[model samples]
Target chain A: MVSAMICLLKMPCAVVCSKIAKRGGAAWISTLAYSLAVYAGAPDVDQIFSARWAAGIDDGRSQLFELGWRPEARWRFNDGGRLTGRLRLRVQTESGTRPGNIENDSFAPATRPQTIGETGELDLRELYYERPLDDWYLTIGKQQVVWGKADGLKVLDVVNPQSFREFILEDFEQSRIPLWTFNAERSIDDWLGGDWTLQLLWIPDQTYHALPKQNATYAFSSPRLAPQPPPGVSALIRSSEKPDRLFADSDAGMRLSGFVSGWDVSINYLYQYDNRPALHQRFISGATPLVEITPRYHRMHVLGGTFSHAIGDWVIRGELGYFSGRYFLSNASQAQDGVASSPELSVVIGLDWSGVEDMFISVQWFESWLSDYRQGFTRPERDNSLSLLTRRYFWNDTLQAELLWIANTHDNDGLLRPSLSYELEDNLEVRAGLDIFYGKRAGLFGQFDNNDRFYISLRYGL
Target chain B: MKIQQLFGMGVLLMLICEAVWSTPLPDADEIARRINARDEGVAVARSLTMRLTDRRGKTRTRETRAFRKYYGKEKRTVIFYLKPANVRNTAFLTWDYPQADKDDDQWLYLPAMRKVRRISASDRGDYFLGTDLTYEDIKLETRVSMNDYRRKTTGEDEVDGHHCYLLESIPVDEDTARELGYGRVEQCVDSEIWMVRRSRFWDIKGKPLKTSYFRDIRKVQGIWTQHRIEVENHKSGHRTLFLFRDVDYEHGVSDDLFTQNALRRGL
Candidate 1:
C-alpha cells in the first residue's frame, strides 16, 4: 500500500488509473489509484471565494468631478492555477475649460478611449492567469510589473508606460498602462550560497505613452511635455508612428535577484522601444517658414540593478540605470533634425525610517545625467530631483495621515500632496486631500499651478 | 480474598505516595528551556482567521493561510492574506535565526505594487496587521526567547482543569524592556504538556497592557497545536481573536515558498 501511494504521488493517479482500467487491470489497484487521485487533486474547499466591488465619488474645488466603480473577481483551480480580473467604470465632468492639448490618441491605438462616451468610460483594467509548473511560476495576460525600489519616482521601473491624464497626480497603479506579458520566475536555493530568483519577461503589447485629451482638466500646456512654437514659426505636428507588428516589436527583459549578506539585490536588463515619441523635424524655408514635426518611436536598451538593506528600523534602497539610444527634443541648428540621441544614466536612493511610534518617514534623491551633452536640448545635461514622504496612523490604525512632496531641483518646481483617510468601517473609507503645485512657469510642476485643487472622496467596498 | 484485596490497595496507595513525594519539580529555567524546545512538527501549514474588535464594539475580520518550516537551526515562515479586498494577496515572509544577536530578515509583498519590499524587524513590538498582538508575540508563539528575560517560578494555579506552574519573567535590562515594550510578563505553563496556556504583559512603565489566552489545544500528527488564541488590551478596551484550523504537519511545503519570489506569487 505504501509503494502504491508513492507511485500515485509521482504522476496524476487518475490518468494512470483510467489507462489501467482500459487494459483490464486488477480492481483493487484501479480503486486505490482513483481514490488517491481524488484526494490529492481536490481543491481547498474550505477557502473563501469572494468578489470585491468598490464604488467611489470624488469632488474637487476646481470643479473636477469623478464617480468610479471597480469590480474584481478571483478564481482558483484544482490544478493550482489562479485567474483574476478587474473592470473599471468612471464618469468624469469638468466645469471649467482647459487649454492647450493634442488630438485624442494622436500617438497609438492603445491610447484611444475604450468606450464610446463623451463623459463616461467603461474599461477592463486587468485580467491575468497565474500558474505554477514544476519549479517555474508563470503569469500571463494584461498586468503591471514594478521593478524598482524608489518611492514616488522612476529609475529602473520603466517596464510599463504611463498615462499623464492626471499629470502625476494619480497613483501609478491607476496611471500605468498595463500590457500583455508573459512572465516566468524560478528560484535557485544554493547559488553562491545565497537564495536567488531569475525572472524573464516578454511583452508584446504595443501600447505607447498616453497624453490627456483636449479641454481635459489636466491637459499639458508646458513647453517640455507639449509643443510650444517659437515666434513667427508656424509648426505642423504630424501624428506619431508606432510599431504595429506584434511579436516582431515585442519587448524582452531578464532579471536575476538574490539575497546575500542581509541585502536584497537584483540585476535587470531590458530591450524595448521608448515609451515617448521622438520629434523628427523638416524645416521648410522661403515664403513663410514652416517646421514640420514628425513624431516617431525609437528602440532603446536599459541595464540597471536595485539593492536594499534594512538596519535597525531603517531601510535603504537604491536603483541605478544605464540607458542607450535615448532621444531628446532639440532646437540646435546643426542639421535641423529637431532630435538628438544620447546615452543617459539615472539613479535614485531612498531611505525609510519607522522608528517613531506610529509614524513612517521616507526621503529620496534622484538624478538623471545625459552623457553626450548637447547645448540646445530642451533639458539640461544633468537633472536632479528630490522627494519626501511622511505618513502616520492614529486611533488604532483606523485613521491615516500622509504627505508627499516631489521637487525638481533644476526647474525649482514641485508638487505637494497631503491627504487624510478614516476608515468608517472595515470596507468603507472617507478621504480628503489637496494637490498643490508651485514654482517657474516653464518648469514641470509650475506649469500646473493653475490646476491646484482640494478634493474629497468616499469609497465603500463589498 | 478481602484480606488480599486490602493488602493490594495499601500497596498501591503507598506507591502513589512515593511517586508524589520523591519526584522534584523542574526549575524555572529548565521549564523555560523545555517550552522553547518543545517538539513542534518540522513543517506545518494551517488556516488562520483573525477578528479584531475595537473599543466601540465594531469588529473586522481577516483570513489567511500560514506556513512554517525549520531549516536546521533557523526557521522560516510565510503568511498569505486570503480575505478582505483591501488586503487580499498581501503576504509577509520572515527568516528567523536562533541566535539572539542576529536580526531576523523580513519582507512584505503588496499585490497592488507587484514588488517585494524588505522591512526592518527591529520594530517587532508594533502591533501586527492592526491586531492586538504585536509582531514579537506572533513570532514567539511556537518558541520562547530564553535569552531576553530573567525567569522565576512564582506559584501554582489551576486553569481549565489543568495544573499550571506560574512564572514571572522580568526583562534583563532597561534597553531590552524598552525594545520589547514590556517591563514584565507573567505566564501560566501547563505542567503536563509544557505549553504556555496564558500570558499577561505590563508596559514599559509597569502598567497593565494586555493578556493572551491559549485554548483548545489538541495533538495532530503527533504534535501538540493550539487551535485558538485571544488577546485583550486592558487600557484600550480592544480585543483580537485568532482561530486556527485544518492544520497539517506533513504538507512537505517547498523551500521556495519562503523566498521573495514565492511571496509575490500568491498561493
Candidate 2:
C-alpha cells in the first residue's frame, strides 16, 4: 500500500517534468529533482538513493524510517497451504572512528567524524510458509530471529546476529527469528497459557555498521603474509585469502520463544548458533578484518529471558542471558574456547515511575560477564553500565522536555548527558543536547576525547 | 397432568433464580451517551499545575495549558508550556479521532532553533507537558465502556449538591492498561448533568494506585463542564491539578492553528 501511493505520486511528476522540457533550465532542474525523489523512494531495488518517507519512527534517541509492500510478501495462504517470501536490499554510508589520522593515532579523541564507510547489501531477508491449525501454528522458512527483551541502550540483543553495533533498525529490529525449519505454537486456556514459538534458521555471516575504532573487521596493506608459500605461490595466493575479508560462515541454528505467566514473562532462547567472528577478529586471525559483531569462535549457543512486574506506580523489568561457543575479538577474528566451560552471561534491571500522566523518571542498570572476553574490551563502554533519565512538562502545552544521566562501570568511566527539546508545531521539532563525561571516555562514551559538542537535529514529517 | 404440572414448577423456579443473579442493568445507554457527550464540540483552554513528590518527598512544580477543539472527524489539541527554563516556549499539535484507535497525530514546534517535528506512537509514553501523563492519556475513552450504571446505596450523601452516578470504567485493551496503568477506574459524575466528580484507578490485580477528582461542574453554553481535575498519586501523595479556565465551546478553531506556522507564532 505504501509503495503504490508512492508510485502514483511519481507518475504525475514524470509527465509534468517531461512536458516542461521546452522551458529549458527550469524544466531540467525539475526533472532532476523529480528523478532524485524517485531514486530515494526506490529502496526496494536498493537504488543509489532512497526516499526518506519514513513518516519516521521517533525512538527516544533518533527518528528512523521505512516504506512498503516492503521487505516484500513472498507468500499467501490457501485452503491447504500458505506461501511467503521477502527480498531485502540496502546500501549504507557511514563515518566511523575518528582521530585515526597520522596526527592522532594512539590517543583516542572525544569525538571524531572520520569513521566513514559504506556497504551494499542484498539478501532474501525473509522467506517463509506457515500451515496453521485451530490450536497450533507451524512456520518454516529462512527467517531472522530477534531475541531482545531489555529496553536496552547496549547489549542483550541476543537473537539473530546482525550488525550488533552502530546504526541499525531499532524498533521491529527484534521482530523476526527465522530459519529453514518448521515450528509450532499452541494457545490454551489454563492456569498458565501462552504461545510457544519454535524455529530453526541457518544464521548468516555477522557484520557491523559504522562504529569508529570498533567492530571486528580489519583492513591492512602489508603485501607479505604466511600460508602463501612465498613468492612462488603469489599467483595461487589470490585464492588463499584477502586482506579485508573475515573468515566466517553462517550456520544453521534453532530458536524458541514465548510468553508465560499470563502475558507477563517473555522467554527467549536460542541454541546451536554458528558463531562467526567480527571483521576485526577475522582480519587479526586470518589476515583480514571481519564485519560487525562477528564472533571469534565457530560454534556457540545462547539462552535468555526477560520479565516485568508492576509494583504499584513502579514497573520493574529485567533481562538475562548466557552465551557459549567461539568468542573472538580484533580486526582479524581469532577463536576462543570451543566449549561451554567459559561462557558469558549478562543481566539488566530497570524501574519506571509510570503512574504520572505526562512526566516520568526511570533508572536502569546492567552487568555483563565474559570470563574469557576474547580481545574483550575492558573499556568502560564495553563493560558494565547504568543510566537514569527524568522528564517533565511546564507552562501548559507549549513545551515538551527531557533529562538523562548515564553512569558506566560505577561512574568511574561514564557520562552525565542532558538534553532539551521544543516543539514549534506539528511538522517541525528542534533539539539540542550535551554530553559531559568524566574519567576515561571513548567509543560512544565520548564524542571528542575530553571535549564536548552540542548535538542538534530538526525534522519535519508529512 | 401430574407430570406436566411438576415440570412447570421446576421451570418457574429456574426463572426466579435467573432473575436474582442477572445484574439489573440501568439506563446504561443514557450513561454512555452522557460520557460521550461532553466537549463534543468545544474550544477549550485549560491551565494545568503539576506538583511531584519523588520517592524522597522533594517537590517540583510545573505549569502548562492545552488549547483544544473538536470538529467533525477531528479533535485538534495544542499544548503550550507556561513556566520553567529551556522549555519556556514550546507547542505541540495533535489531530486525534482520525481513523484508528484514537490515534494522535502529534507535532512539536521548538523556538530554540526554530523548528517543528512529529512524534511517534512508541514514544507517546515518554512525556507530555513535562508531567506523568503520556500522549496516550490525552486521547480519551480508550474503550472505557459502561458495565451497569446504578444508583449508589448512599446517594443522599452529596458532596456538592446534585446526586452523582457512580460508574465503573473497565478497560478492555492494553492501550488503556498501559495508559491508566490500572486494572479499573471507578468514577462518579452528577446523575442529573453527567459532569464528572471524582475517580479512583486500580491496577489489573486490583491494587489501589491513583485517585483523581474533577470538580466545579458548571454549564457553559448549555454544556456541562468540569473546570477542575485533580490527579493524586495514591502511593506518593503527589498531585497535579488541571483547571479549565476561560473555556468556550463551538468557537471554531482554525485549521491554521494546528500548523507549524502558527506554533512559531507563540503566546
Model 2 interface Cα RMSD in Å: 14.3
lDDT of 1 by residue, A1-462 (tens): 976676667566466445544444122333342354354443222211221111212333445566777766555677888766555666665433211232434333432334424566544565677988997889987778889999779878798888776788766877787777899987766555578888899998777777665466666666665556667888877777778778899999999988888999999999989887787888778789887877778899999999999999899999999999788877777736878888999999999998866778999999999999788787788999999999998767788999999999999999999989887777677788888889987888898887777777776665
Candidate number achieving the greatest DockQ relative to the actual structure:
1
Give me the TM-scores of chain B across the candidates: 0.90, 0.71
Per-model TM against the reference:
0.86, 0.44
lDDT of 1 by residue, B1-267 (tens): 699999999999999998888755568898898897888878889999999899899988889999999999798999999777667779989998888889999999987677888888877877777788877787777566788899999888877788998889999998788778789999999998999999999999999999999999999998889999999999888899999999999878787779887787777
Interface RMSD in Å per candidate, to 1 decimal? 3.7, 14.3
Query: Where does model 2 exceed 4 Å of error?
Result: A1-146, A160-263, A272-297, A326-341, A371-383, A393-399, A441-451, B1-267
- How closely does chain A match the true chain A in each prediction, as TM-score? 0.83, 0.53
Which lDDT values do the candidates have, in the order given? 0.78, 0.47
